[model samples]
Target: MPNYWGPFAQLKEQTNAILEVANYNGLMAELNDALFIDRSDIAYYVDLAKEAGGPILELGCGSGRVTLPLLSGGYHVTGVDNSQDMLDILSKRMQHRSREEQSRLTMCREDARNFQLGNAFSLVIFPYCSLLLFTDPADRKSILKSVRRHLTSSGLFAFDAPVQESLNQERIFELDLPIESGKTVVTLGIKTYHEQKVMLENSLFQVAKSTNKRYTILEYKKLALFAEGELEQELQEAGFYVYKRIPTLSDNGKTLRYLYVCGKSDTDTYPLWHPYMPHNQLPNHVLTLVSGQGCRVTDQHGKTYIDASGGLWSVQCGLGNTYIIDAITKQLSTLSYGTLFAGRGNEPALALARKLVELAPYPLEWVYLTGSGSESVELSIKLARQFWHFAGLANKNRIVYLDQSYHGTFFGSMGVSGLYPAKETVGPGLPGLDCINAPNPDNCPPNQDYETYALTCAEQLETVARLKSDQIAAFIIEPVLGSAGVVIPPQAYFDRIAEICQRHNILLIVDEIATGFGRTGAWFCSTHFGIKPDIMLLSKGITSGYLPLGATLFSAEIGNRLLAHGAGIMHGSSHNGNPACCVAALATIDVLTNQQLIKRAREAGHYVRELLEQMKNEQPNVSGIRSLGLMAGVALCQNDHKPATKEQVAVIYELLKRKGVLAYPAVSSVVFFPALTITDDELQTVVQKLGEVLSSVQLVNNGTRMR
Candidate 1:
């Protein structure tokens, strides 16, 4: 009655009807019998522990989510859970298994918040949002203190909790409450307020199937939502220091859940504006290019702005090109879409694979196709792991990435990507990823040339390899840092990284999702950097952003190994290798080669760099400028020599929007990614408008006048 039980009491009552009508206890028992007890979570944690070489303890191991599989994997697992019902289920499951499995599992019935077993654990886990169950601040503090005590000196405590914003939103709790079977009427409820530290009230409504029975009710008292800062402060207060708060999903830049890694002494904080930040303040608009001729596009608004940013930095042949449109139209007429599974393949899929192989720098002979950049990155990691298993290097399963690099949005990609802001809203991602600091040639130690900075960054890769050694299976990086302020490394940076991977027997993967298809003045950024990675990931510009298409190109050696082991890769999607998307990519490549757009990109990039340099010199507020082809970053500095203030950057961005120019601020800078084929006159118009915006905006620094 006092709301002490939180949402669980409501959940029980709401489910009572289903239980009473359907023999709930019997159904639950049957479910327990036939459930097969999914051990994937356990297998995952076990694999992580094995890789980390740890004696691990899993807290809140409800229904043996991570305990049973760890036992099956032959890892010594000590599982702790507060619920006797869940532990009873796990005990029954273990009893049915062989003696060998039962030997590896140890169970303790105790509250995770204050339990201690008199032994230190190398890895401690609080899985499945179990930490969020502690609504009281004191209880949460006690849990963190207990975890710290249980962890060894160098142990890591990994846990997950629903993000505060995720809980504040109405959708998460707005589930449809079921009704009698006659009409299957249901009610959807949403939490609206919180009171008295534990009381949460919600608004509810009901709708009937086949009949109109809709109503709204003010439902009261549900759950507590903790802000991001509150969670961090609590952890810090309890003797635990958080290093990473990894997001669960990062598609359009919002994450609902977070996976936090904390340790006793691992107190490290990074610059807050990583890719996973959920601040959607940028004024983004889609310009519908209704018609075009050659490399020009006429938008529906009748105002053409040279298709800069290339429709998310992909359109290499410009927009509304006849060649690509015709190819796509033809493909839709012939075979719009088809499944590539079960040895069945389409002409477009095969032809596209061959084309990628032909164009790849090294002996990349095989291709795996997907629908987007995220899918491509996921497939690359899966393939790398599979290859390691096939080659009998079971211990080699870790992925290494660079900080501030944009990989993709899938769970695995989110784990490997270094953009924290983009993933902040999304909660806990796949585990077993290591991120190293990326090279910033423009902002590195003063007096060091870009080339020297590149070399130093490449050496960091060797440092990671030496530290992790045989545990690392692959190293993935973008040839030029794309999402993190469009930072570009020196020419020799990627080349040296490739050499280091070769020396360490770690597969090198290059993500060219944004920079491929002439976005970086070449067919691929890897080509411009003069490095041939063992695996090449491509999307975006592949289809000129007309359709979603991503491909993972593998070297001949890895391809042959996979082929010899099996007929095809194990993973796929419903829209994998869509014929229409394939045709779009093929047409896009054809346009780039036949129209010489890649060459245009190189020349245009040089021109844009010169213009930006002129602007930087003229505008004192301009801190630094870096450009590679159409991708550029114009960093604005504050009077205090710090990064530009959000308000200042926002003013400049809004001014550009009003002046018919479109660009977004990245970190402490504005990203300028115009289409590759803009004419000289059109390019001048963009710069002139930008100059006008800067001139009008008041700045913190005096004598830094915009002309």
Candidate 2:
């Protein structure tokens, strides 16, 4: 015997086994037909079928009682049941119908709680008290979720179950009914009631008059008697609402049942799995955003927080900009979508491409558009290899990227991601990819000047090129290692890298996805280092997160060469240079330029660095501060000089969130990517709250302090 500790310990183990009637012998199914074979219940479901149209899914469709009638009524039906014996009988009955009628019916022997038909249905029905068979609340939730996934956007899910209050007592009853050919069936049902559930055990007897022989079988069912309002709450949690409810009588008014016509909830009726989050769990710190304006966003609870991180380093022009919104709405009315393929183009796409060329550096006279940053990086990889291939140097297909660099999330871009967790489990990525250490100041050798350390890291790239120049196509680098916690290398690093790549005849691919459109105070971060890239990647701030758009701008020489190759481009997206997205980008650039936010970003950069410096003086946890324009990162450490642990960082973030400051925690650093339009007071409020959080933060486990 095992040790037990609760008042319900006695109920932990019971000798009476739960009945598996759904898998029982064929006689039980016949007995089921005899006991409740009143085909009168069919009329109610038939009326429901008329409301919820065809392409219906019937759960627990035992022996096709409800399904057969629905199918005969000119409705398309797919039946799901757990018992193969029951399904076999249904199949035998289905064969009697015409081939045309049979064609409309599909049958599957699978559990209702977990089934994947890969087809959406207009209506899903669990008729005849089928849902009550699942006595466990968890099983009910799972079955409801399965129904949600199989429903169309406007679909209906219907089911009927006895009201919990109706199962208040125990009763015994016996019924005898005649079947075909001098046969009689008798069923004895004994109902036993518990606090939360009721069990019905039945002994079914079949007798044949000619042989004077009888056979008996034992079967039982356990049904949940949910507490008041328990099922309604569960239904809401499962992303559904009872659109209509009808109370009806069953078993001669002794039992009260409810017919639930549930519709999918408009707001997140189905659970959505966010990127990089585990499918089985949700982050405790995550919030459902309901609305946003300026540099603040309100959660579902109506509490607003400063949008300091600018929504994953996008949203440069701030949220709810009227200019961008108007452009998008107008473009949608003018041209909802237009193909940029097969020599077809829209005015907005053409205008946006021209605007990009005008703003880009010298010799970057041509542009190709994509739908997002990931798509842009994927296109760059293909173009890099294709450029060499068309130039008759097919062997120069190798690409190089820096450590701690994040390009995008697609397979091609993921292969080049410096963060191991992003690509480790899902690789081997593209071949011929190499990684050089990122020129981070924190990683510089002791007493070594920052410029020399940056040059040394840049030299590592030249060394790789010298040894593999014949096989190299391009070297990709982000202006700053954005996802690597905003590691800003010295300007000398890019100066040396540009000279080395040009000397080695290797194309330079600069990924300004996170740092473009004034995130770094300039039009592009590449301009700050004065390096003219052979190819430039742009996104994120391009449309200020108002829309999704990305661009790949190439030097005139490379563009002319590819154009002369005559096969057009080898890659393109269906929504490449979508007109609405193009106009959003155009309006975003207009806002940045007209508002002079780029210059404001430079001013904000200095102000933030000064505030962080003051905060560091008062709080000893801040080990370092790195900033460029509005993007900045404050590195945190313990007294022993080790980087702060993830738990410690999470505690600080939770504290910050409580104070209504939303910031991004990358690795050991709390990075700020505030909107360029953020006011001085808003910026100060975020930094001051963060300082308070750092000061009061308790060290985990070891209890060490920075001071």
Per residue, candidate 1 scores C-alpha lDDT tens digits across 1-707 of 33313443466456532222211322232332222233223333553465334677888776665676667666777889877777777787788888988887788999877897978888888876667657778788888888888887656788776556654423434333344321222232334244433324333223343356332222333444665487777776676766445564332567755667676753333323433333221111223458764345566667654445565676677766878999999999998879887767799988999999888877788898999998999999988888888898988888999887878778898788787444656777776688887886435777887788778877888888899888788999887776667787876777688778889899988898888888878788777767778888999889988888999999888888887888467789888988999999999889889889889888988998888888778776677887888788888776666667665676576557546666776656778766677888877777788777776544654222122
The alpha-carbon deviation from the true structure for residue 321 of candidate 2, after best TM-score superposition, in angstroms, is 1.1
Top lDDT hit: 2
TM-score of candidate 1 against the unseen true structure: 0.58
Score residue 460 of candidate 2 by CA lDDT.
92
| Model 2 agreement with the true structure over 36-82: per-residue lDDT tens digits | 56644565567556545558999988877788788878889999988
Give each model's whole-structure lDDT. 0.70, 0.79
By summed lDDT, the worst window of 10 consecutive residues in model 1 runs over 278-287
